[model samples]
Target: MSDALNVEGIIEFFEKNARHPLTPEEIARHLGVGRRDKKRLLAHLDELVERGILVQLKGRRYALPRKVNLVTGTISMHRDGYGFVSTGEPEGKDIFIPARFAREAMHGDQVLVRAERGIRSDKPEGRIVRVVQRAHQTLVGRFEQTRKFAYLVPSDPRLGQDIVIPRNARGKARSGQIVVARIDSFPSKNRNPEGTIIEVLGDPGDPEVEVLTIIHQHGLPHRFPGEVLAAAEEIPGEVLPEEFSGREDLRDLLTVTIDGETAKDFDDAVAVRDEGQGRIRLWVSIADVGHYVTEGGIIDREAYVRGTSVYFPGRCIPMLPEHLSNGICSLNPDVERLVMTAEMLFDAEGVRLESRFYPAVIRSRARLTYTQVRAMIELGDTEEISRQGEVYPALQVMKTLAERLQERRRLRGSLDFDLPEAEIVLDLQGNIEDIVRGERYFAHRLVEEFMLAANEAVAGFLSAREIPLLYRVHEPPSAEKLQQFQEFLSHFNLKLSLRQGQVAPRDLQQLLDQVAGRPEERMINQVMLRGMKQACYSPENVGHFGLAAHDYCHFTSPIRRYPDLVVHRILRGALGKKGLSEHEKQRLAQTLPEIGEQTSARERRAMEAERDIVALKKCQFMVQHQGESFAGIISGVQAFGLFVELKEFFLEGLLRVSSLGDDFYHFEEERHRLVGEHGRRVFQIGDEIQVRVEHVDVERRQIDFVLEGAPPAAAQGDVADDGDS
Candidate 1:
């Protein structure tokens, strides 16, 4: 028996043979126990049966029973209720949990499962016997009140099960109203789980209703928990002198914070100055959130579990309270704040010679938005750079330095992906007003280059120091995808060559440069981008293929992301009095990879939520302009239909191939298009055509259109807006 176990002497007899079949004679020989003791232990083994751990047979064979292998993992459920358990197994394939096997384990649940190796299908499958932890018990959906009971049909299909409410718990839910429900339980004998109507959102098909659905679907807190808010309110909203005890004093240095107009969490700032003999020193300071959120503290643990702040277009689910995230931790102009600074000295060639990171106290002299910076770029008059001239001249110098760094990076084969990101303008009541894109200018580029350089420098230092930290790694796509891309691109007379270990970022960069100023440039660039893998954080350093950076980590936004917090903590531990223990280091090493995966998944979900909202808004916008013809380019072509992007407001819609009037279109897989058999009409990606809005589907967030004539006199009756570039 294990020394840790109680009643060891008699248990020793059972443990000797792993509680296998044993006659009294054999048991007596193993434990040197009397017949009486053997009988007593046998009676105890019978008691263990109550826990389902051990079983006894007619042959007196007492062995460990076939209890399911108790594994804990997050559930990834599908629309149809079936899901898979994403076990953080380094080698074994993920276990599939069939619809019935889920056993009420909702999506993202940390479930305890008893899995056996059994399969009638190709994939491995497992059954969930118990749920260790529920990711969320509350869900968002529309309530349906029948004569007898009510039901909450969830907006997120991932929930997979409708919550049924009996007459008493139904509340005032009408026949068809949007509502949030709190799950009570899934009865052993019932098909649906029971829940209570906790909130009434609104009627279905409302603009804000879609966003609320997403917020509830993800289980994001609309605001801070009461205790958290109370704790935040208790803390002062200013940096205290005692808190800056050991931090380096850089408040005297000129620094400016740059962000979007709506951004309140000003967590980063930049400053640059000529050091001597054509060398410059650039400083990147990030808000020292770690100083406020201490280890093992309530807020700290919550932040760790969340991993990052989630940003919606019109809202944000912040990691820290606004009093901190947008107040004390915010590097507002003319106010002293604690920061974690990365200082680097660079030569005329933009090659960094020295760098170091440490805690510091800084005062940002100005708060500049992208709009103001863009205006400055337009004027070409760098006079009004910052609120104070002290920070303004430094910003000009920084912009010059950042440009040089960008040139250096581009020369080093870093691919530039300046994708068009759109923003939604909502009124006070959260109604979509307009969708506008950011003006691509030097202002945005300067900020990006500086942050990229700082992140790269920190990443390099961490790697050189052999620090175990998370690095964002982007892997090259599989050979199969590359070959398919090559074949697909051949249709456009574009040839892309790929050889083993010869996939240089510079090659793609050069291709993009060559395709510049062409109509098909954006389409080809998007396709090439899709052929690359997503970048994610991991303890192991796998160089980022897109950036061509040998080392890359996120050290710029500790306010938004958790890995940055870990980096700050590690850097502090490595260089400060608070040295990390070996046990803590080991724990980080074991946990980081899994946490990275989860955070990356959440990031994707947030992006999708935003996209889904935007798509819905576009559909709403289209509903108002139905039956009007607008010029559009084919975004996607399928056998069933074609997705078209409207030229007017940049909205997208799908044109059903069946509605193309008496023509049978066959899908040409090789060409990524559909071809009409009789009319010789063809619909392929990037084909510009005028289409009248056919229908708008609010629930599905889809727009249907019917194809009309060709491009509006070379795609819109005018010299296609030169500013489009």
Candidate 2:
């Protein structure tokens, strides 16, 4: 039996019944302690209070700290030394903690905090009482040596404090070099942490070294282990004859892949056929990654850890090694590859009549680029169509079906927010060449419509039978966010109908349509998009709001996404003649929630890493173009600065209010603009103006700009306003 005086057990009891505070006598009775042991239990409770595990009320009642208005959450620190704790509650309210109350808690650290509601302002406040876990044991930063002392300044701005490096802990790191340091001691409230330099990266000015620093800072695995490489090498290059048994033979189907010019892994392919009487049969073939990488295998575990493939400026960190991702699993032309097929029959009005899912072995008829497909279907280029004999006819029919599906989605109020995405250009040595906005054509939309149809069909099939699986769910926006968005739009004379504390997707669709082609179109669309919740994976079906679909799952691109691979496996088990066993079904039900959370985190991490690299490269490109003037649109306006996006280049920079030639500017938050008191000039969102690149700070990944035609302070007395900034 456990000890009767166990302090941990006493704390656990309070934690388990945290909602109900218990007096000393009640706690003693609940612990089954007699009068003789009551004194010992009280002593233990006092000790727990001392350790911040429990709190004693004014009436001498005991309770868990969380029960007494204290909460637990992860802290996100800022460069200015303050932090915000995210409690992950449905209300989405973050608790602001002052720099003094942080108690040395680092960024990403989990901590217990005492919340003070509606005290200082409308926003809630919190104080860190105890740190539950540390997020970092090693740090990446630049090393500096003084006359008699040394220190490391962290590369991540959120680290909040520098680490002191003792004389002996300097290792071989030289001054002004980037190095990885292992923390020898965590920080106290009044003292900075100490660390030892372990690995010395090269100088900070080198491009290659900066990229490596980013990878190391984010804890990304850049190289495969020896065992994993060995395992990848063991896989054969060709599909075995025995592997095709019991699989549908789709070699005769006119299937083709449409991807970018540089894409090596073609995981999805499309085919179409006219069924006569205004009907069509569409096939979406996705590479069967589950067939090659079994569950709990080395490669599978690695893929799970990586989550998704991360694409940088000129390189890719694939989830799987090249042997699998680009070779066997890729649906290369003329190669027999295993795939899972979703065959759906649709009427002329783009309503699904029937759908079927099955395992299949197929040889891709041709590898087509988005440009080539657009040339045939939209541009009607005879040369492009003649290049592919039988596949050309199938492509034409696919276009017609895609158009119908798009029209159907339009009627259903599926939102299509066309935000411009930037694509960075690089030279052979990985240096910045240029930045260009991503283009959209009919070919891109056609492929997207077909994929969406296949995903919806597969998801609907499994959902109808109540199977446990990870679904890509996009929930509706929270009421608080919607109300804020409505207030923001009210300034522009637009009204959103909020009914019964909820708004429909069509309401947003109508608003977007009303503002189309206006100067405020981009601003309104961006704010509305921000008000919506991000799409994430969940075992519980919440439906997809953005897609306007009752059921949706990602079934294509299994080679790049772990959830897609898991979906393929589940479908394979369920499609068999015998179906799944009771044990298998129960196991899936028990494990899918955790997998949903894990894959969601991994996807976010990959996206963040990709975004960081792009920003880094963009900053590098701007260094060469400093002082060059370009036409730009005001993307954002704040109390301090205006954010401008260049027209000819996919780049954005900030123009500080201080650079406006001695005018005192005041930010008007309600109208989303800034006004100068002396000159009476105004700058607002969506106003086109000319700006010159003033400065670029590569270390901070920031670009600064100045207004191109602003007069000097001596000559500003008689200038006309022109109603423009």
Candidate 3:
């Protein structure tokens, strides 16, 4: 071997063969470095170790950092400056980074970390060694200007540092204005990131401006690109004659779309009929969005990027442009719309006898609202029945079939939260008019049951044929979370039937049933929901725990959800070729995983943006109601305070323990309550009391409440001291 030295080559070789450790002599020999270059090779190895790219083992062998339990993943920075590295591995162990060790890593920043060896704990600990990729290219924050410079204090506290802007880099943004800043330089270990204001959002106090800030922070695109919109505008208003050649003609079927009164995008419709042999034939026709938004097109790329529609109180940022989502792709009544239908045959007991999938052309007979359907089916209002006309009979049969399916689901241990959602009624100018609980009637459940059956059938069929499909999976909860839940339920004298250190959905369902209609039902349901894992899209069939289904997928809302559209395209391809070709199969295998990951992330981003909007609006609404007393329940408790949820507004506010005034409250973590030191007053979840809205901070989206008096009689307990106010 010739005498030579290549530091970069040596590092690349170790990284490529990361699993194999090599001694210095072995590395030198493998790289063809002779005795003359031994000193150079040794110096390079020591340098690599210093840079944390390689680790020296006990036997004088060197290995890549990961071979010594190091991991590389994205950081989830906490507001308190500490963070956790989410290593996308099977074991799912996130390494916790303490505040001092965070190393200026911002939230969502990709970094390489090495696990702290010899830490015997459930959670792994690690420190960031290298910044692999920066997640934050644009930052949204409040701008503060000085004589010669400006800085941005990030609205997201997790960013943890203010960005300094040079005097000339400060654009039109003024002090105290909310702005979007483009990063000019990333932070080093000693200095904060430097950025300049790219766009001014406006005053932080303005509700509209606050919402825009959230949208920008989440990187949610509110407007379609010119090319995507141009593509959407190209889609025909009606299905072409040639396009109907392979589709079954079902225009005469009495199908109806049941949705909310304000819904414009009707992605799914249902029709049901009795088959007379203890069977029912149900047709779930979903909008054939894939037919128009072809794969690899601009519209398809945009939809894939969006993943799903983002809906706020009075606005919608749709996945597809309005021209498609609200026009051709919508299953509007009295128009011939193309659809992918699931023809499902079920017995009287709700067991699926046969199922088939095919493309079809259908004209929706009617567009019905949930309230109207509820009036017809549940209340039997004569006006509603007369108005429905021919569709009334079909709705009757669908109600029967839906009930049977729901019962079947109940028997299979599906966990239904049945929690009420807050409906924010806003005026034309976007001020909150009223906040009320949205009623869920039989109308909603009927459509839900039908969609569930269709999704299950499609997923089951695709799995049986060994076809590639995106499944909605929710893994089982961890033992630690479940155990904590059991401890919380102990306060209410409730217990879950755990088997073999694990709980089934039926166990949660039983607990929910017991708490149904009770005062604590809402609190218990919320706790159980927090204990469950989040559902996400996956290429693997892991089954859905919340639905308690062996197979489940998003197959009914292609117009709004990208996964459903992907499913439509796959099913369409499957129908033609029986199965994917080897080349197509290989392409799909590589593509679907990335699609799953990106779509899941998009869904979460949309959810967070939606939550931020609602919270902002609630704070704005409460700004006018300060000092007013309202009945509330202690929805949450921490060492810092008790969180109160108002009965009228459906808004939550913190009742800081220090505000108690009379005594020092001791936080009882095990019981999820606070105990007063001098007076022995105990406040916990589900305790009803009167609270006056003390203050509202719209900028921070915070509401502060003070206890008005002792809780109601029903809330009184032995722990409550007589001196409690």
Top lDDT prediction, candidate number:
2
Model 1 agreement with the true structure over 378-400: per-residue lDDT tens digits: 56555554434565566667767
Residue-level lDDT tens digits of model 3 in 1-725: 44336667887788675458888888876788888788888898888776556767779998886777777688988666789898776447788988778856889987878787425676678888777678889999999987777799998766878999888878888899999999989987788889878899999777688778888888898889898888777778887888888889999888999999889999999998899877999999999998898898888888888999998998888999998889998999999999999999999899999999999999998999999999999999999899878988888888889899999999989999977877899888877898887899999999999999999999998888788888989988878778888888888789876776589998789889999987668778888898778899999888999999989999999988999998898888778845677677678777899899999999999998898888778888899998889999888777777888888877789877767776767889777789988899999878998998888877567888888862322121133321111
Lowest summed lDDT across 10 adjacent residues in model 3 is found at 716-725
| TM-scores for every candidate against the unseen true structure | 0.80, 0.91, 0.88
* Ranking 1 against 3 by TM-score, winner: 3
Off by over 4 Å in 1: 1-136, 157-162, 184-194, 205-209, 381-392, 517-520, 577-584, 708-725
> What is the Å distance of residue 153 in model 3 from its true position?
2.2
Would you list the clashing residue pairs of candidate 2? none
Candidate 3 ranges beyond 4 A from true positions? 1-64, 88-94, 117-125, 577-579, 709-725
Candidate 2 vs candidate 3, TM-score winner? 2
Weakest 10 consecutive residues, lDDT, candidate 1?
716-725
Cα lDDT tens digits for candidate 2, 343-453: 999999999999999989999989999999989998989987788778778888998999999999989989988687899877888787789998889999999999999
Q: For each of the candidates, give the backbone clash count.
A: 0, 0, 0
**Scored by Cα lDDT, where does model 1 land?**
0.74
CA shift at 200, candidate 1, in angstroms?
Answer: 2.5
RMSD of each: 7.9, 5.0, 6.0
Show the colliding residue pairs in model 3: none
